[model samples]
Target: MSLRVLALLVLLSIQNLFAQQLSPEASIRVLTIGPGYNLNDAFGHSAFHIQDHSQNIDMVFNYGVYDFDTPNFYTKFAQGKLHYLIGVNYFDDFMLMYKRQNRTVQSQELDLDTGQKQALFDYLLENYKPENRRYLYDFFYNNCATKIRDVLQTAVGEPIVFHEPEAFQPQTFRTLIQDNLKTNSWGSMGIDLALGSVIDQTATAEEHMFLPEYIHTFFSSATLGNSNKKLVKQDKTLYTKQAINSNKSSFFTSPIFVLGVIGLFIVIITYFDFIKGKRSRWLDFTISVLTGVIGLLLLLLWFATDHTATAQNYNLLWAFPLNIILGIQLLKKQPKPWVIKFLKFLFIMLALMAFHWSVGIQVFAPVLIPLLLALVIRYMYLVYYLKNEKL
Candidate 1:
């Protein structure tokens, strides 16, 4: 027999033996980190903490780690093809990092027998291996927080009953996300614009684990299938977040204020052009171009990407992609008669957008209210001007 083959067999046996000998004193914990001020950190994070007193081993298994150096990183991220990997860190280092960020760190020890603990530990070690580490990340489903719930189910080899946390109210995926963001902030507006109506659907109780805070709450009340034993044995606050001075952005710099200013300018210009009975071709051209470009990007996000959350976007109603061609036609001394119909179509699209919002099909950014009203006025003015010019 080859020495290499014999050595490999012996190594595999040793690994199996070590896995089986997981100390009864070992404990598996779920760590929940509080949200930070940044948009990326708004949702918070979750990880597995494995500590074995007998073996003097303490490590953290994190599913949120991603490499910025991956090929076509930005492009893949936009396409929703980015991969996140499991990363192992020293327990102290993990706690210290979150502590420095002034984020609250909470830990929940699981109530599991030695067999279940060993199974979970072995599973994490297997997942930590290079070839098995990376997985496709999804914001609403297979993310860092969801991984905690998933790994527990897998290791325990049973369905987990995630009971509703106290005072738990069912909320749409979008609502759940917006709960973590300020209403008039640019971050919230961007999310409303980029994501689509799919997020408007209410999330199931078990599905709410996609957020770290929910993971902590749900796991606290979770139990193994057909068993009344609680999933979490105890909870501890490792580091309480310290209150800091408010660094909120100025109100003038907020999305509502900025967009409101721009919208008011458009309305004032359109009113003047209506009184003068003259079309402000430059202003119309600029608005059409900007809205058209944004619409095209939204369309691409819906159609050309793997993002499930970007489907059926309603923002395109106001920012019509066909406006780009209409803008170019307006630059002509004599645009075709069809331009009038196109203007009317844009007005109808605005009305439809309102209808969707009212009927709860989709919820648009509140910051866009002023801009939408301005678009309606401009479209109506353009239609009247084109009709009078033809007379």
Candidate 2:
């Protein structure tokens, strides 16, 4: 059903229940459905208990990630087979879904209600403190427990105390230390945050997520994922040496390989220059050779091993070394004052502008032309200076 239609049915049900000589002793509750918050489905796999006492009803909070909604419906919820459903959804839509069923609140802001609707809205304004939103300090508050509390109080025809979600603690400090060492690599930030600090290696976030993925593809067969399914392994692609050489590595890889190659080249180039004998152009050659070698190493490392994360650092490793050679060629006996001033202005301006995400270059490819020009200008200055001075 469309969200609008499903909402109307809930409101109609509430009115019918109230008109049919509603018993205050009769229970009423809302079960939210979505990622990590699945309290409504009888057959749903959830963590929260929803026991509908003969005297009252229990609401379940279900969270899910859109279309992947798990709709298990046979389990008795009295004991707590609900909860732990978290699905991705927009914030406003989430709030609107529940306001429709606060049977006790005569006001219906989502639809339309007159006197009681306005009163309930006023009450909501007083109670729903936007400042207390958790993601600001924490977000689980609005999305989980507090939401369920609103439903229960509405159903029972009385005020109910909203339980707080568990607090983040530092107990995992020791375990995090060990884990950091064990899994050391790039992109660990997302893994650490997603896992939380429970510290139990068995349920560690990285292991639960990355491991399942690693196991499914790395070990050859899908037996581990298909048969021993504790968590469903999403489509994580497996990488191989052949694929890395071919172009499959564009997705993500380590920077270590590129770094190693750069280090080796630097050593080789340095040794070669020492043996070849020095000229008046020695400084220019040294800087160009070392910087170029190092920069190329960085580019390769980023491309071959490192995951292409932010574009600030990229696979354009050749740019630096190439600029060095060009700069040496441009060195001069005396630089024009105007040339010096313009180069300085360009470099400083570019550096200052680097952080602006809205800058044209960041937003579009055409913006890069200016950066290329600036690089050329800098190269000319270096070359001009190398003969007698330096930029």
Best by lDDT: 1
| Candidate 1 lDDT tens digits, 115-232 | 9988888898788666888899999999999999898899977778889988999999999999999999999999999999999999999888899999999988989778888989
* TM-score of each model, in listed order: 0.94, 0.24
Model 2, which residues run further than 4 Å from truth? 1-132, 137-184, 189-252, 277-391
- Cα error, candidate 1, residue 162 (Å): 1.2
Residue 164 of candidate 2: its Cα lDDT?
21
Instruction: State the weakest 10-residue window (summed lDDT) of model 1.
Output: 9-18
Clashing residue pairs in candidate 1, if any? none
- What C-alpha lDDT, on a 0 to 100 scale, does residue 248 get in candidate 1? 74
